[model samples]
Target: MQFYVGWSHSDALFSDYYSDCPTLVSAVSDNQGTLKRFKNKPNKLIIDCGSVFYVKQQKRPTLKHVFEIQRSLIDECPNTSSIRLVHFDEPMFNKTSLSDQYYAMERTLYNAYEYLKVVSEEKLPVNVSTMGVIQGFDRASVHYSANELKKMGYRFFGIGSLLAKNQKQQIEFIKYAIEAVGAENLHVFGVTGITQMAEMVRMRVASFDSTRPTMAAAYYQVFYSNPFRTYVISASRAKPQSDRLGEPLYCECPVCKENPQDMFIPSPRPYMRLRSIHNYYHLVKTIEKMKVGTEREEVV
Candidate 1:
């Protein structure tokens, strides 16, 4: 599965702490300044409405408003792989009542349908594809959303409001959605969780996005993906992995080459950037291994 990193601002902002990743997921409304930098760029562009379209009275950007932003982004960046319309997801973890959850999901579907109708106009660019969003709290409702999106002609569907679920819970959710909408067309929104990356790749996820590697680095922690497991080590206790293991923390990563002796960076910005790069490199590599069942017992 291709990983699309959700970036809120210019990649230049994280340039110092760069992950060296190319496929970017940006909200149409927030990434205007960065959009121009990638004109005909080789990297993949994935656009979506930046925020959930269900905020309170004045705080909200309405469904129509989100669609307008999406239209504008598409007009400016027609090469994007796909763009998702407004999704009215329930609160994180889906804390609301089932009835309320279903209501919000239905609203999201209707809004996406309406937005697609508007973008079907002759004036809009046709190269960019569209992805609908699937959202709900329970099995039936989740399937309902996914199946309905398929019927509405959405080839790509983003599964939203899943950040709070555990790996097992999320797997179930993904399974249901996949059964309703083919796995090749599903994108798990805002996720590249460690516990599930192998499983997700096994399940044939079309793509996913993650901010954790960069976010953890910003908070003075290092995200390390070991051969057997993942670790988030605090920079305060940082040391050479060889201190105990008799080998380098990560000899192959650029970060390790730069900080060869200590295997730890004192400067926050550089440390964060290098850690992010190392983490991303490991994650991408690990999934490749899992895909072929190479050294399959290693992760366990």
Candidate 2:
């Protein structure tokens, strides 16, 4: 399974630190200038329309406008080996009404179809591919959405609008999508939890993306691997808890090796960035361990 670290403008300088990192950038948040910094880096990139950002907006950008943004970002990454472009998806986050949920799913499917049509007309590069965004509220709806995307000739699919759901619901919806469209080439958007990561590995998901490391750092939380764990930074203004750490753990990550004390500073944005980089290192290590364990189980 491929893990794509969510990238932002602030992460531009450190983006190249992890040579093997696959990145996911949102068109709604990142611009061509921000991506230009990655022009020389040969990382795999996923550019999504950032539907969740516009979910509450009364007016969203036109398909053509959004497509142009995505295209421009892709152009900025000339050295990237592979780029996946995701269509604008109407996220079904707070839509409690069944009708509202259905409308969101239908709108998502419509966008997928139109996006693929434009991609075909534009004749995007061989390395560039479109990912159909799957949106639904239940098992039946989820399967229907996946089937429609498959029928529209989407070889790669991603399931979204799962952030609001519980773990059980999230796994069930993912399973529903897999049942309709096999797990091969299927990516789950906005994954954060360790248990969920393990489940995805078990399911053999093609890929998933998350900004957990950055978010955790912003919230003064730190991550350690071996057996994945989180701790609140001891220097944070927030009340100290049992898991609070006064100093950084012994990590082999480049950032930690260079300045482990920097992670505990918790003030300057650059320090937070270093902490995020360190946290990301641990998360990737955890995923690697999970993958290795899964492979061993298969062999057994």
Candidate 3:
């Protein structure tokens, strides 16, 4: 399984530091210039239409406009071997009524069809594959959404708006999607939980993305792998949500090797970035361990 780290324009140097990192960037957040900053590095990238950014707006950009933005970002990464372009989808987060949820699902299907049509007409390169976004509220809706996208010739599919759901619901919806489309090319969006990550691996998901490392670092929390524990930075004024750790653990990551103390300093944004890098390293290690354990079980 591939893990794409959610990226931001402020962390443009991330690719330079972690050359092997697979990254996901939002078209609404990062522009072509931001992508160009890491063009020399050949890492896998996912360019997603920032539907969540426009979810609250009464008016959203046209499909053509958003597709153009995604295309422009794709152009900046000629060296990137793999690029997944996700269609704009109407998120189902705030929709409570059945009618509202139905409308969101319909809008998402419409966008998927139109996006595929545009991709065909534009003749996007083979390396640039389009992912159909699946938006639904229940098992039946989820199956219907996935089936429609499959009918539209979407080999790569992603399910989103799951951030609002509980873990059991999230896993159920994911299973529904896999049942409809299979797990070979299915991607789960915005997954952060360790248990969920392990479940995705067990179920053989193609990929998932998260910004948890950076988000945790910004909140003055640090991560350590192996046993997979989190701690609050000792110097941080933020109330300890987890155990407080004054010193960094033994890590071979560039940030830790250079100056482990940088992670403990919570003031400057650069320090936070360093902490995020360290946290990301541990998260990646945790995923790798999970993968290895899963593989060994299968072999046994």
Ranked candidates, highest TM-score first: 3, 2, 1
lDDT of 3 by residue, 1-300 (tens): 989988878752567777788888888744556776774554798989888887767888888888888888877877436999999888998899999999999999998999888888897877898899988898899989988998999889999999988998899989988988889879999998888888898899999999989999999999887778899988999998899999888989889899999889996899999989888988888888888774333222
TM-score of each: 0.78, 0.94, 0.94
Task: Please say which candidate is ahead in lDDT: 2 or 3.
Answer: 3
Tell me the deviation in Å of residue 119 in model 2.
1.4
Which digits, one per residue and each the tens of the lDDT, describe model 2 over residues 1-300?
A: 999988778863445678888889888745556876763454788999878776767898888888888888877776446999999998888788989989988988999999888888896888898899988888888888888988999889999999999998889988988888888868999998788888888899999999999989888888888777889888989665538999877899888889899889888898888889888998898889888874333222
What's the lDDT of the predicted structure labeled candidate 1?
Answer: 0.62
Clash counts for all predictions: 1, 0, 0
Return the top candidate by lDDT.
3
lDDT agreement with native, every candidate: 0.62, 0.84, 0.85
Q: How accurate is candidate 3 locally (lDDT)?
A: 0.85
Per-candidate alpha-carbon RMSD to the true structure:
4.4, 2.9, 2.8
Residue 229's lDDT within candidate 1 is 45
Residue-wise C-alpha lDDT for candidate 1, range 1-300, written one tens digit per residue:
877665655332332333334454444556554555553432345666664433533576665666665566555554533444433343445446667776778777887777677667635445567778888777888888888877888788888778778778898888888888888988888775666766777898887778766665454444444474444353445443422232346547666766743434545565565656665566666666777866345664
- For candidate 1, which ten residues in a row score worst on lDDT? 10-19
Q: List the residue pairs that clash in candidate 3.
A: none
| Local error of candidate 1 at residue 201 (angstroms) | 1.4
